[model samples]
Target: MESETYRGYNVWGHAILQQEAILAPERFAASGTITRNNKLVEASGVLGLFNAEAEAEQAGLAWALAWIDSHG
Candidate 1:
C-alpha cells in the first residue's frame, strides 16, 4: 500500500497478491481508498489484475485521482 494527500483527502493505493494455481505466476489485485478527516469517503472494490505490483498500485492511484477530480 502507498498513500498520498490530495485535495485535502487521504488517498491510498493497494496491491494485493493473487495466485490461481501452485505453478501459476503471481498476480496483483488493485484497489483504492479515499478519506477525509480520518473518515472513510470512498473505496474501490477490485479495479483489475496486474502482472506487476507497481502497475497495480499505479492503477489504483490513477483511479483515486480521477475520482477526486470528478467529485472533489
Candidate 2:
C-alpha cells in the first residue's frame, strides 16, 4: 500500500474526510475560512508559557496564520 500523510493525520481513516471535502467543494478548495472551538485552536499557534489561557488564544491565531503560510 502506498504510504502518505495529510496534516499529520494518517489517511487510513480519512475516507470520511475525503468524502466530506468532496461533498463540499468550496470547503476543500485551496483557501477557505472555517470556524473552530477557541479552546482547542488557541494552543497551537501562539507563543507563551504553556497552559496560559489568554496566551493560548493568541497563539491559536498565530497557529492558524502559520498554517496559512504553508498551505496557501
Candidate 3:
C-alpha cells in the first residue's frame, strides 16, 4: 500500500488478492481508503478494479479525489 496526501486527507492505495483454489489462480484488485485528521473517513468502495497495480492506483486516486470534492 502507498499513501498519498491530498487536500488534507491521506489517501491509501490498497491491493486486494483472492485465491479461488489452492491449485487454481489468484485474482487481483484494488481500491482506495481515505483518512482525515488521523481518523478513517472512507473505506474501499465504489472504486473499479484493474488488472495492473499502476492502473488500480491511478483509478483509486481519481476516485478518492472525486469523493473528497463531493463529500469534503
Best by lDDT: 1
Q: Each candidate's TM vs. the true structure?
A: 0.95, 0.31, 0.73
User: Of 1 and 3, which scores higher on TM-score?
Assistant: 1
Write candidate 1's Cα lDDT for 4-54 as tens digits: 999999999999999999999999999999999999999999999999999
Ranking by TM-score: 1, 3, 2
lDDT of each: 0.94, 0.30, 0.75
The regions of model 3 sitting more than 4 angstroms off are 19-26
In candidate 2 the C-alpha lDDT for residue 32 amounts to 16
TM accuracy, model 2? 0.31
RMSD (Å) per prediction? 0.7, 16.0, 2.2
* lDDT-best of 2 and 3: 3
Q: Flag clash pairs in model 3.
A: none
Q: Given candidate 2, what's the lDDT at residue 6?
A: 36
Q: Write the per-residue lDDT of candidate 2 for residues 1-72, one digit (tens) a residue.
A: 111233432211101111255454421111112234322221131133333333333343444455545654
Error of 3 at 44 (Å): 2.7
> Which candidate leads the pack in TM-score?
1
